[model samples]
Target chain A: GQQVMQIPQYQHVQEGEDFTTYCNSSTTLSNIQWYKQRPGGHPVFLIQLVKSGEVKKQKRLTFQFGEAKKNSSLHITATQTTDVGTYFCAISFGNEKLTFGTGTRLTIIP
Target chain B: DAGITQSPRHKVTETGTPVTLRCHQTENHRYMYWYRQDPGHGLRLIHYSYGVKDTDKGEVSDGYSVSRSKTEDFLLTLESATSSQTSVYFCAIRVTGTETQYFGPGTRLLVL
Candidate 1:
């Protein structure tokens, strides 16, 4: 089984500030997926990075996959109040089931 | 959002009772999954099904069992529920030809 660790179990930032969360793995991954779960809601898929050193952006959010394919990051610029939620990175070693990171909880102060 | 629905959005039951949660999806995806979300633990996979009557256990499979009778239906059963099993349950479906998973609204269960 693969283990993925996410940094900063919890984070709080003033609205309009920047926020970033990192997900690290001990071994190379086939692919990595990011998800966001609002308070009292189910997780929603945000994005997926499959190639080494891949970077993708959606609006103000940027996602990066390390060249080694063992790490990934999500950065939000000028975050809005809607950005408040828990961010999780998921990986599947060689199976259909996914192993999720502990996740980083983000709070926005409006 | 995917056409995934979970039955009994919320439930309250006593210990030692058998509880079953149903996951229905109209997407007709071949792969379906069951996960439990807690405070510190993000989402732990309990079970998943690749096709009808084809299922496998996950990291946290103990005390839980699953069955996929049809392509669109997956069921998770707790033979004897415990207080520790009281958590938010989510059902997800993986799109064909891709690894993307769409989750249902989720089921909140409380065991006393």
Candidate 2:
């Protein structure tokens, strides 16, 4: 069995501010993926980090995979109202099965 | 939005009843999963199918079972539902050998 934990269970940020959430695993992962679920919406695929110590960016959002492949982070710069949602980090231990973290719910203030 | 659809967008059933939720995908993906979302729990996987007639349990599989008779359809059945089983259920699909999973609009179920 695999377990994934996320930090800052909930984050509230004012518009134009920055936010970051961390994900950690008790076991090593083969790959990790990120997803965003909007308010009252389904979870949507964001990105996946496969290689250790990998860093990828999507516009103002930056994702990082730890060197040990046991942790990851998602950082959003200058957040906007559209950024309000729950961000989840999912990891696969050795195959297709994925275990999702508790997720970090974000709320943006006007 | 990835050609994935969930039926009975909302359901209100009584306890001790058997409820089945259907997930249909036009993409014909090899991997299909059922998950339930609750407060502070995020999304907990119920079951997943790798192919036709192939399914396995997930972290929160109790009281839930799934069947995949075709590559495009996955069904999640709750036998003898309870109040604790009331939550928003989502169906997701991913291509073989890929890590990305696309989810369908959730089906909100309430057991009275």
Which candidate number would show the highest DockQ if scored against the true structure?
Answer: 2
- Per-residue lDDT for A22-77 in model 2, tens only? 99987778889999999999999899998999999999999999999999999999
**Interface RMSD for every prediction, one decimal?**
0.7, 0.8
How well does model 2 score by local distance difference test? 0.92
DockQ of 1: 0.85
**lDDT of model 1 at position A89:** 95
- The TM-score of predicted model 1 comes to 0.98
Q: Which run of 10 residues does model 2 chain B get worst, by summed lDDT?
A: B93-102
The digit string of per-residue lDDT tens for model 2 on B25-74 reads: 99878999999999999888999998999999888999998899988999
Q: Please, what are the lDDT tens digits per residue for candidate 1 over residues B1-112?
A: 7799998999999999999999999978999999999999999999999999999998899999999988999999999999999999999999888888999999999999
TM-score of each: 0.98, 0.97
* Candidate 1 lDDT for residue B27: 78
Candidate 2, which segments miss by more than 4 Å at Cα?
none
Q: What are the clashing pairs of model 2?
A: none
- Model 1 segments more than 4 A misplaced: none
